[model samples]
Target: MTEARSNIAPVLRYAAMRRIRSFEERVGELFLRGQSAGSMLHLSIGEEAVVGMTDAMAPGDTFTTHHRGHGVFLARGADPARMMAEIAGKESGYCRGKGGSMHIADRALGHLGANAIVGGGIPHVVGAGLTYRNRRSGQISVAFFGDGAMSQGILYESMNMAALWHLPVIFCCINNQYGMGTRVDRSAGKLGFGGRAEAFGLIAAHAEGQEVEAVHHAARDLVAAARDGRPGFLEIDAYRFYGHARMDKSPYRSPEEEAEGRARDPLTTARARLAAEGLADAADLDRIDAAAAVEMDAALEADVAAAPPGLPTMFQDVYAPGTPAPRPQADRLRAVLSEAPR
Candidate 1:
């Protein structure tokens, strides 16, 4: 059960970024073919470095992510097949096909879940940090939220509590310039996101979200501090290649901005770095790309072949054991009428 030997740093980062890019492109194709379950699908195409931070985390560390978190989940070692199954609404999905893309969660990997609600999962990390402290587990909790969530009150509240209790939680904000087509300048005030966290008396770290190594270094430092019973904040200045959701074409963004964002593709940058450092050759990178394609193809095939959840199962996970759900309004009215004198 020995861990596999690691690849050179640049090559490792390139492979990880390639895998995510391939997986997400395939997902976009699936959605186009009407194979996915829900209307909401947020791809993390240009934000692979956020996932690279996974290299810095410990086994016991836990995290929650925003809706656009496929890369993070994959980086944290989630099975590609199960993830595709969840998006396809197959019975084999992580949530029995109930959670879909937005709520994929694997407790074994310490990935609590991805939240679709803006700033919904921020406080959950605080709760996890508090639990770790109480249980003396020495585990840190990380929360990944978008810049759009910066204005949410719950984020501030969570930071306040984490700082006050010296809880082990990290708030990693992916500032992708835009939050659902609205420029960050329009959404958040002039103050930087890290500054806001510092105002709450927590150590804040800032790093470029485009470079995998840079993100890993910063995350390593912040995670170490969190492990020692201190709360921290991280700001990653990145860009989103696509719009907010599947249907959005980013009409709000200018063509110049779009082109500029596209030019800074993280995968391309990582590949170039690997070559410049003589860490890997073109063939090596191609082999990595081929392997990722084969893996994703098999996963998508399994997801397509998997069965859908049964009707009885709909009510099973929704309620507590032996707790009856409320009767339908029509049924209740009929019962009341029958019992009355009329």
Candidate 2:
């Protein structure tokens, strides 16, 4: 992909956003169909524009993502069918049905892993950055977390380390307004979020997800700078179109607030932008969306049809190879009975 947003066609950008939205909608459907592995699925429904940052990321760039990360991973070149299979806990998943929704990762794609903890994944990139700096690899690491991580001491520590060592890293906070029902304005004493990053001596910037092109352009500059040994931080303001999880009804926010937030949907905004600028027409965009829906529909079908790992493989990925595994209770009981009497 291009290292800059302008290098990519406008239709491609809209397609990326539309693809993400479509995949997430399938995720919701997966849950409703009871095929999802767990009830704790975190959807990036309204935060699809974060993929704009992936556009700025060059080959060999590494990143760790937050739990609400399916879209970013997809934009980074994940297979939707396998992704759905993983989330469904099917044997054909990326991790053989182990990582599930919150932990899908593809090392070959430079995704270290997705962390379920709020700020757990933030520091992994700092370590990767240090290695890149030592080897003169010219590669940068990015840590994608949510606004909920802004208060985490680990994030501050990681930022300070990255700045002090001049490590090539970017800590992007996806601020979707609410931190599990507590609004950002209520959770943090500081509002802009980027201001806090600036205090750590890192290059900081902010953008609205409602304008994905704007976010992409902002990221292009910062990503270039980060690759030059200067650390950077970005806080993208997005809205959580649904509750924090599949089961959350988001009772804390009013209908008026949710309506206003949903009105700024980036996917819709990008479609309008493409049409308004003559980069694409309504018919073209409709075809793009129709294709995305068909793609996701097939992915969901694959997920439902895929088989589970089954009991024989229960301990497969849980232990290291060439090491003895603990005996199952039934096996141990059989061994005891055989040795006790004749």
Candidate 3:
């Protein structure tokens, strides 16, 4: 592993970390203030490194994420104001406020979207890879999912297709031990999620997701391999500091488990590494944090001031052009007779 260089620019790394943390903190505040209405809100508090490392890869690479994906979006250069507006149901949001915490999409930044369904986005990423391969675009598509997604059949199917076609796809499994309320040992027949990829004939690599530098190295190599028309899998052993969802107290795991995970907070670990290696000083990190705080605060204010979508939008974006509109109950009988009797 390469030591942190003193001259290396930590701007992107610090930005990713601060954005994720700020987003999560804002979500909590929004929920408390009754501005956000959702049954669950999964916060990626300690798992910032996974996406931070990804930010170091190709700029045009595409990524699809699971419900717990604030980190991925921020690392991919998603606009904080837009994301806030979306979560607040404002028209300026990525989905025009239709997609809340679980479904944010920004194609311009190569973020296909984040899906609420556990393994729903895996096949989408494969399709993206296929599109890139067909066009010879040299673009790589990535799928970010939790450990629970490994059990889903779609994950296996997607992996099979990517391997068979040699598409440029990277399967990133953020194995945080617990899937909702169930622990990995209790749910997974095979605890090794990376090994499952190898069974489908895909190159698999495992890394400590808690370490930013380690994830950066692993993701960098996998991305390079994928760009060469080789599909690969990366299993990142990380943990979420909070519950699976906002409402979950995580009774499945004890308090001790949560504490142990918190001790290895990825953001803190990254900062410590930089400082210990003389790559950055305390002053630099404090400045980065302060700047991020200001940015997030301004974003929240903008999101609150934006307008919500109107009622007419409900019928839009639902069907293709020239598609016939549904007939009313009273008109349906007359239309049927006019067509059939004629």
TM-score of each: 0.92, 0.95, 0.91
| Top candidate, metric lDDT | 2
Candidate 1: pairs in clash: none
* TM value for model 3: 0.91
Estimate, for each residue in 1-342, the C-alpha lDDT of model 1 and write its tens digit.
Answer: 012324476576677788888889888877998989977899988888886577788887899999988988888888888999899888998889999999999999999999999899999999999999898898999999889899899999999999999899999998887788898988866857888999999999887877887888888898988888889999888899998888999999888998899787777777777766667766777899999999998888888889999866766756777899655567789989999985
Which residues of candidate 3, in runs, are more than 4 Å off? 1-5, 321-342
| lDDT against true structure, model 2 | 0.90
Supply candidate 2's per-residue lDDT for 312. 69
lDDT tens digits, residues 1-342, model 3? 124554564545755787789878887776667666465578888788776457655878888999998888888888888988888777888998788879999988998989999999999989999899999998999999989898899999999999999999999998888788888899987777778889888889888867877787788888888888888999888888888877777877788888998888877877887788777767777787888888888887787778989966755666765796544566788878889954
Residue 74 miss distance in model 3 (angstroms): 1.0
For model 3 the local lDDT of residue 57 reads 58
Off by over 4 Å in 1: 1-9, 322-342
TM-score of model 1 (CA atoms)? 0.92
Q: After superposition, how far is residue 274 of candidate 1 from its true place, in Å?
A: 1.6
TM-score of 2: 0.95
Q: Please, what are the lDDT tens digits per residue for candidate 2 over residues 1-342?
A: 212234335678779889999999999999998889999799998898887788889889999998999988998889999999999998899888888988989989999999899999999999999999999999999999898999899999999999999999999998999889999999999799888889999999898988888888889989988989899999899999999999999999999999999998998898888766767777878999999999999999988999998886776756797788767788989989998977
Q: What lDDT does candidate 1 reach at residue 102? A: 96
Candidate scoring better on TM-score of 2 and 3: 2
Error of 2 at 157 (Å): 0.6
| The best candidate in terms of TM-score | 2
